[model samples]
Target chain A: MVIRPIVSGFPPNMHKVPVFADHLMLAQRFEHPFSQELGLTGFGLVTCLEGEAQFMINDQRLLLNTSSFAVINRGSRLMINVDETPARPVLLFFRSILADVVAAEIFHRQSGHDKELSYAELKDYRLTEYVHYTHASVKEVLEQAIQLSQSCASFQALKTDALLRSLLQSLGQENYQAIAVSARLPVVKQSTRVDLYKRLSHTKSWMDEHLTEDISLEDYADMALMNPAHFLRNFKTAFGITPHQYMMERRLELAKKLLQNTRQPVQEISEQIGFDVLSSFSYQFKKQEGLSPSQFRKQVTTD
Target chain B: MEESQWSKFKLRVNLNASVEEAYRCWATPAGLEEWFLRDASFKDAAGNAKDKNTLLQEGDTYQWLWYGYPDSVMEKGTVLKANGKDEFVFTFSLGCPVTISIYKEAGETIVQLVESDLPTDQGTMLQHFVGDSKGWIFYLANLKSILEGGLDLRNKKEELVDVITA
Candidate 1:
């Protein structure tokens, strides 16, 4: 274990947050893959902030990219594999008492009341190992923890506990959101529903960002690590729209924006929005907007 | 007299960006508008206004407004230390100084803020220390998000009142 200096340079209050909050944080840049059995006694947060890594839990392999975070419950058999790519993954181990406090806060905030909640009822698959797209706040703190662990000058512990506390709270909220999204999945079992939704949502966000590029269904399925058929079926089931239809809607939105905002030619705009042929772009645009691209541009300009 | 109320706090965040870029985010008015404010203007000691993209200098006074605020709602303060690199200091309120330091630690750029000399009265403690710290938390997150290629989280509409990003 390599211990770095972080505490000496920081003020007393600045250094005590994660330590006093009771989270043991570890952040390192892996030069090579280290495959080791992760003996987690408490809840663990594994984040691949940069590059990619893979984890094996319950005999299932889960890949974590920059867009995803993995959570492991206590006593879970976990193995992490870092690829040859340089990856900086931060690991945080925290006690159950803190997790309970965070879980309680989630319920309190959700109900909009300061009501007492049962721990057993609250404790569920959030404790199990699964990778999902992170909540923004959780991702923010993970960035902090990565630096805190890296900068511990001469700590009693790399305690970013205050930061970790907020992180656990965010993590609980993420689970709640996952549960909400799971309700949309057509799968029978609750856990399966949530898992399928996570995988599909993860792919959908990435796909949305790359909508202007020409990407095949095979590539999209490969990104989700599912066969194209299963990916297509579950994607529609979870999101209520087929990938093609969703892409078309999003592309039309982009097309309209470009047409209204820029003087770029319609043919150029069609190619910019990923249409291979101008005729199909015009057809889709006219169907969606009730006017051709040039007509839509003229109407906007006049109005 | 013993200090009975909390006057100030320190916030530290690690951004996945360069020290130079993080410094630019705080030291330049254009960069400030990119993440933190609807408008930010700085004037030199002689009351000469600086260019929008110019780096602030020590003793330069600044006016800042937020995204959801009208131009009438603004903060007027003075820059106390501007190193032109990774260190900046400005008066957040008349008696309060907020110093920002940017550096690299643990393979990430760390931006640290120390807000000191706050008004120690109960109302100010609850409002300035409590309320203002909440504002910093969101802006810091916004700064990180913008620099890290995530969505710009600021609520830009003037009518979007009471949002954390605003």
Candidate 2:
């Protein structure tokens, strides 16, 4: 495959650098009529500038509006087109090396694990997929990049590139999932609902932090500063489940993860998940997972 | 991250336009209305228009009444500093409190925004509020497109959703 860069002025060494590209670029919206094949070596980000664009990645058609951005997975086959206008989009390409180093440092992957480069995997890559910037902040980053790219000196552009890469990595999946949940809701101010939501949110965090404890409905109400009856009614309203049920469900989920990841026995797993009795733990695990503890472990290992 | 604490984020942009032009785009009722929204008005806490030096003065609070919303949002905070040509600092309130500083960097202006003293609920919510965060991410992209490319996405709200999801 002939190696070509859509933009000019990058160093020849940049072509061979093995990390995600840390630089800002600007491009008008334009179509690449010829399909491009990117191999597992690197990935790219295209932010539409003037017009609409379409990125066909691994058979999934992702449309890029003026502000819409899409991450092109490494080695993925893509057909990129600016259909609304002939102007091409500004593209930022990051080689896998940056992610590799980050994963090694933050996620602590074993030294020699091969990083998966498929589109499906990249979709779950929280760092690169979404950077939750305020509407104004996003403007600021793009505008800064544009200025730096157009600068007579390379210093600003280099710095801007570094900042951009860091920004991409900072956008974790946790943020993306939360934002996805918020955008789907109707815009209405329900004070009662909001208050209930506040309590539920508090309870969720409290539960996560106290997963090892013998938590009860009364304890949850105390955390939220509400009466037990009030807590139960509002918790149901906010989460569609009573506090006790929610806590149990979360505990079982944790138990399942522990069982799958750890070599601990069922009794230990049950104890770890706040269940005092091994039989009770076994029963609850079976009820939630549709399998006994040993059977679940066996299925996980074999699969 | 308690309700009493606040988080801050900043973005700087280099505009092809001049400082006054950019300032006008953000400051004036007419200018802010054009780029920010179709109907824009500035009011005080008691609901009155803010004008002139009062509009740009330190310690002065301006409430921006946006279209579709009955209540206006407030902007409070002293001007930490201002360069008539390209820089200024001000405090603003969204649903939460934030201090914003705007400055010009070379050809572009940088807006350093610090949203602090957020209630624990807001902070924790903001920390994990994925849906709100993503919306802001996309909205910021839209802001850049409008400012630089003269593209307005609000008009294409439905089509935007369609093509994006399609």
Candidate 3:
């Protein structure tokens, strides 16, 4: 696994600030399945810039695609995986110290009082569950943060603090409080759910890597350590699409890439992407994309 | 127009260090991080560094990250020349060529930097020339301070105002 760290900095001990930020790009293919266990010491804000990624936070499966954002509370156990597709993410880490500073500032502005607030008091308003949002405003702020991070201009730290404050304001405290309350009720069944999701997500990643190979429902179910019937139902429920449909969609996406990039004949391209018959490949291509494979190539080439 | 027709800005500072030491500060990643950038790494296309704790060579590329910035923000450039203990040239922001020369004068190291090949357009020339001139002046003073007084004057904190303004 080749992970390129674009920018990373951690505040020194005894510093006024308690924040660590990392921007990483995972562009290389992993020869072996790669996973990392992260025990976050601070609140984590992860923004996906491109491609797809899957992360398990406190045993809850979270999918991140382009412009997706996830906020993880401090002390959460997170398992992160880079999808076969290249994934780039910007991660901002801030400790409870910084959180307290922001909270105090907010409180002072509202009440005109400079009172000290504990982390426990902040907890009531903090996001406990790993929250995910696909909002445009979040993406815009993250983009600005990325730009400011690259600039050599002075006052970047001031700008970064403002951006962080803006992010917290945008994600209203009431919404997090509601999510935190609801997340507590599912603890009893969470272990099994975590196990099931982990296996299913692993199998799904396997399917993505082996898109050019023929795979069956039984193969994926076995990988998930479940019977085909149970696996089929759970997979559909977990991903909102049946395994067969998911595989077909992946194949069609690959077919589109091949059609656009390569000069191979339709029959060869179909076989290369695990389609045994040209007619079935062309039919699926037309069904998914309004144009046939050849038409897509011609249209894309002309454009 | 000939390359000589390009506008050039030069700045020189006298440091209480040897010529070799001043050159080392400019040529090595460790020296750069002390007073210039926050992080610096030099690597080849194969993602290998010849010596993890040494000076960069001609043709080597570098990625530089500044303090108090997001990890995703970095500067990348290739070393155009590295004359032993005397002169170094590299591409700065926006492909502008920068040359740093070190000389022993008056029992001190005089480090002179020249940034050339700026845009010839009247507006661009004024903006870049003026902006870079101010920036270099501040940074050179910072380099002198770190070398002489052993104090870093960078605004490493997020709340501090910028020293350089538009």
Residue-wise lDDT of candidate 3 within A131-242, one digit each (tens)?
3433466666666655544454543433444565556654435333333333333235754544565466557766776778888889989977899998898777767789
Best by lDDT: 1
Listed per model in order, the count of residue pairs whose N, CA or C atoms clash below 3 Å is: 17, 31, 4
| Two-way lDDT contest, 1 vs 2, winner | 1
Best by TM-score: 1
- Estimate, for each residue in A1-303, the C-alpha lDDT of model 2 and write its tens digit: 012344444344544422432332435434444233332324556555566666665554666655456554455555555545565555565435554444344443223445423333323442233211122344445655554344332122223434454545543233233233332234365434333444455465557667779877788889777898877876675456777788788888888788789999888888888887999989888898899999999999899
Roughly what TM-score does model 2 have, to 2 decimal places? 0.30
List interface RMSDs for the candidates, in order.
16.2, 17.6, 9.8
DockQ of 3: 0.05
Predictions' DockQ, in order: 0.03, 0.01, 0.05
Measured against the true structure, the TM-scores of the candidates, in listed sequence, are 0.47, 0.30, 0.40
Model 2 local distance difference test score: 0.49
> Candidate 2, after superposition: displacement of residue B117 in Å?
43
lDDT of 1 by residue, A216-275 (tens): 889989987799999998788766788888989999999989988999999999999999
Cα displacement (angstroms), candidate 3, residue A167, comes to 18
Pitting candidate 2 against candidate 3, the one with the higher TM-score is: 3
Instruction: Tell me which of candidates 1 and 3 scores higher on lDDT.
Output: 1
Model 3 score (lDDT): 0.64
| lDDT for each candidate structure | 0.70, 0.49, 0.64
